[model samples]
Target: MENYPTEIQEAVKIMYEMRGNSEGMMTWKNFPLAKQIITLLDSIPNRSEHHTPYDKIFILNFIIDNISSSDTPRFTIEIMEKELALLKEVLPADLEEYNDPLTAEDIEEELQMWRDYIDTEHFSNEEWCRKYSHYMKFDPIERSEIWEEKYYEIESKIDAELMKEDMPRGLGFCFAYWSSKHKVLAEMGIEWQSPQEMNPGVVFD
Candidate 1:
């Protein structure tokens, strides 16, 4: 809360109170989708208040709008596809600037970590999973029938339950929102890539 900017802080403050608590409870859940986003946007540390930069605002707004919206169901496939594209489009591009070849071992480790990424974290979920997959790989078959079914099944369990309108989901997911938050340890200059949990069916090479 202390890290938040003034305007965003104001909005969150109002919303917090509106929901009857600082934690913004709804239906026995933690801060509701609208409140979560309101808190997140409000938390952005910026020069001014609600007037955050375009990219930042765009990112947050995209997340807030969709997550809390009841409209995605109207055209779940189309909306999911579009949101997936938008997420990839907006993801930070700094990772590709790696200094050297990503060796087979490196690939293997990354793949495992990617799989481990499925482990539920603070705020991350399927939406974050799909979006991250989109940005980290090339020509990913995100629209596969399997993915479609998975998305349908997952989305069916959600509706207007996001923290914000449609900014994004998984804000708390191991640094899903902040690119530098819970960085991959190996990539952060701490250690070499390590193998992920062993699975015979999975191969890095």
Candidate 2:
């Protein structure tokens, strides 16, 4: 790891420690993929002295994505779980830069936004259907009333239903929206604040 950036060196040390042999020897065979990753990180040009949260995210994503590629043996659930758990032990804990310090209020806000997004999209579809309904010469009056009543019924009860049953469904919606938002952030080269428990598969990796 000599001559590598300090951040890369630190990341290498963490990876090595996570896969260290019980006999106190650093064995490359313990984690062949990790070795390749270290090599790749070392080869990066003009590496920075300290890796920002975003940089570390890129490195983590690079390692995971490469290890889970089609050319390689797919990462088993156990391996993926262990790697993520071990990485959490070594990676920096603070993630304010990612704007994902979720709280009860934050979750509520996100959930509301999620609901609004869904509502808007649904209404748009309804509007399109309504426009098409006007062109229907066959029972247009009956059809239009049916569409309007359906929308009204759903709109009236959707919120109550969402917040009903101890709000379990609403909570689910919150997590769903939060997870998707985090995925988008990850794609944008930003670190995710969430632990990504629901995304156990490689699709989210």
Candidate 3:
């Protein structure tokens, strides 16, 4: 554990905590494939500092995407195995060779860029409204209309001066990593919303 970074340690703590909780324990018991993947990642040797938590991040996202809930029947062994095999095949042998390691500063800078980007006249208000409408407490149809109106009203008053405080909170390192990765991809002329397409089992939202 001393060899792992703080982020990786935290992720490992969470996975073990999940296994300890009653609901999570049941979920893990039912979906041993997910547990197996975590175990496999935990066994990787001589992981570089720069590549510290990517493996843990991958495992967490895999669990979220595949294990719908503790009570759901969505955990399918065949599908999990297929996805895992595909991921191993596609993953680069040397991830550090593909890109530099993302840091907290990089995340903050990227998020600030997002704030600036959203302030520009080119920002899509409708898309923003649609993306965050799920957070509204109203009924689905009502929430959509309400959020649309709310966003437009705020947009009109703000006049393209979107601020960082207006952004979502509690996104954690996974999002920060995704944002940094997205910036790198954009510079390379690649357009992808999620890294899952290229790095299977790794998703950000």
The numbered model that scores best in TM-score is 3
Residue 4 local lDDT, model 2: 52
lDDT of 1: 0.35
Give the Å error, residue 78, model 1. Answer: 14
Give the TM-score of each candidate. Answer: 0.19, 0.22, 0.24
- Every model's Cα RMSD, please? 17.7, 22.1, 19.5
Angstrom error at residue 149, model 3: 21
TM-score of 2: 0.22
lDDT of 1 by residue, 65-148 (tens): 333222122222333333334334332342243344223353344334434333334324345447556333211223233332
* Model 1 regions more than 4 Å off: 1-5, 14-205
Arrange candidates, best TM-score first: 3, 2, 1
* Candidates, ranked, lDDT: 3, 2, 1
In lDDT terms, how accurate is model 3?
0.41
Lowest lDDT block of 10, candidate 3: 134-143
Better lDDT candidate (1, 3): 3
* Candidate no. 1 TM-score: 0.19
- List, residue by residue over 64-181, the lDDT tens digit for candidate 3: 4544231222223233333344334333553454355333354344333334323325434344345445222212221222332233233223322222324333456445444554
